[model samples]
Target: MVKRDGLKWWFTVAMVAACWRKGVAAEAQASAIWVMGDSLIDSGNNNFLNSWAKADYYPYGIDYYRGPSGRFTNARTFSDILGDWLEVAAPPPFSSPTTAGRRILGGVNYASAAGGILDETGQHYGARYSLNQQVVNFETTLGQLRAMMSPANVTQLLTNSIIIVGFGSNDYINNYLMPNLYASSRNYNPEAFANLLLNHYARQLQALYSLGLRKFFLAGVGPLGCIPNQLATGQAATGNCVETVNQIIGSFNDGLRRLVGQFNDGSHPGAMFVYGNTYGVFRDILNTPARYGFTVKDRACCGIGRNRGQITCLPLATPCFNRDQFVFWDAFHPTQAANVVLAQRAYSGSTTDVYPINVQQLAQMRL
Candidate 1:
């Protein structure tokens, strides 16, 4: 009788151990993510906001769902892309209507139009929310999440969440290190100005670390010299990329990479910075514009003037012969197709020149 009882007890204990292991495995598989940054990642969240940096207008989301007028409404932003990944990974029933009926992996976009790390730099153009303000907005969003879930739940959500930050373009272009078209008072000296801007950015990252954010997918500076706005100024003889501006951008990106590395080591050991090589990617596309089916590498697909600059490409303005072939949609932004391609490259780790660490690797990181 005693021998039979021992066998039964051991079997019961084994069953309990197996069940506990399964539960842990399930938790390990699930994940959440959040995106914070500027116009590059900004979805229609800014559509409600009264800002000139809005892209919710027609032609913005045209390629995805079709019809020019419905572009921004149907278009997928960076957050949308990240949300899609989280769905496959965690499979969620998210609360937001935008992500409703979709998998419940927790995620939100805190990106804003014309936002930067510093208050002064962000609002340098005119009236706009600085990068610091966006952080505050992120905190507010977190509070709302906390109200809906327990502290432990919230922490778990954030702990598993991978935060992607995309910014610096606006800061270089519309804010510091360039001539402010809107404001006449402030002047920027490129080298000194970038140092100041980066210092502020470091602070913002530190603040987010305090909030339980560990992993970070950071996009580096892109080829700002190749922007249609800069090219259209009649600076490029052949209307090619502006080398001087590109040099400044390169320097800034180098500094940013070093700064992020420092943060990943010193204070935030768990943080991982993923550099998005917009510069090399765009440069390659420009070098082989025809390969991508782009007819005009020097000019924007949409916008006024033969060289394609001066303002945003409206229906009233000159439209491209074939937008699918063009890399740039307007003076500053890329077309939906280009954005999609870039997102794929980022996810697949195919972009060795630009993205040293792809999203797939970033998603798998424990720290």
Candidate 2:
């Protein structure tokens, strides 16, 4: 009887320990947010890269508490704002030297400035990590995670964690559109180009899935024509954006929405791919700027030239005093204020902003 009782006690202890481990894994998943993409959400990966697509300069992080943290914006990116709302720390860039050991538990940001879905998309910018490379980096991070936690716990953590995959803008902005520098325009039309992107994107997402990421927020490309970059091109008349540019972007967004559906249609098993309607939310903000407290919708706050966008915010350039009122922060990115708006809408807004469910919902989901 004494031996039996001892065995029973050992069994009870083991069960309790298992439950505690599961509880800890759940907590980690609930708090982690892994960011991957282009400059739109790049925290600081470019700082460690030998790339011209860097924002490690004055007036870039002038508003951020850290100051000039390599973010290509006046302040926080969209992921930063969303992390605040979710009560999670903004994942440190994967390239940061400090992103090792325990620092990765919160998560890691693999987004790189000018990075895109295609490996050669942002080659002009020099040495940006392509989406494939980012995924490979994540694999390295995953190997580290597995060492820290049991395989089961690590898988559970990944299944419950939120992964943001935002890319493709550079494929068009720097690749297809730059006819003199790239041959994509001569090779494919808008539909064909978008289809090409989707094909490559599908494979990339599958790679993440194979690595155990079950929840994703695929942010579609926003309206490029409305931004100062396209406006400064003189393709559209005053007070009017290049409609053709917006139309091409729309094709990509539409296909992306369908791709999200396909991913969730019992194909990946417990995988939830949420489509973030960035174009819709941004357009809404532009259509009724006062509703979002934005006053300057046409020009960048720091760029140079017609509509202040001929060139991106030059080093130490004196930006607009009232930066909060402006939409575009430079030729390519949004202001912190605009990022806040986008993050809020993506966190809990209606289907118009985030389809299927929002980030909050995805975090709370059992799967």
Worst 10 residues of 2 by lDDT: 1-10
- Evaluate all candidate structures by whole-model CA lDDT and list the values in order: 0.62, 0.87
lDDT of 2 by residue, 261-281 (tens): 999999999889999999999
Enumerate clash totals for all models, in the order shown.
8, 0
Q: Please report how far candidate 2 places residue 66 from its true position, in Å.
A: 0.7
Residues 225-314, candidate 1: write the lDDT tens digits.
787888877766556877877877676677777776676565666566667766666677778665555566666777787557677677
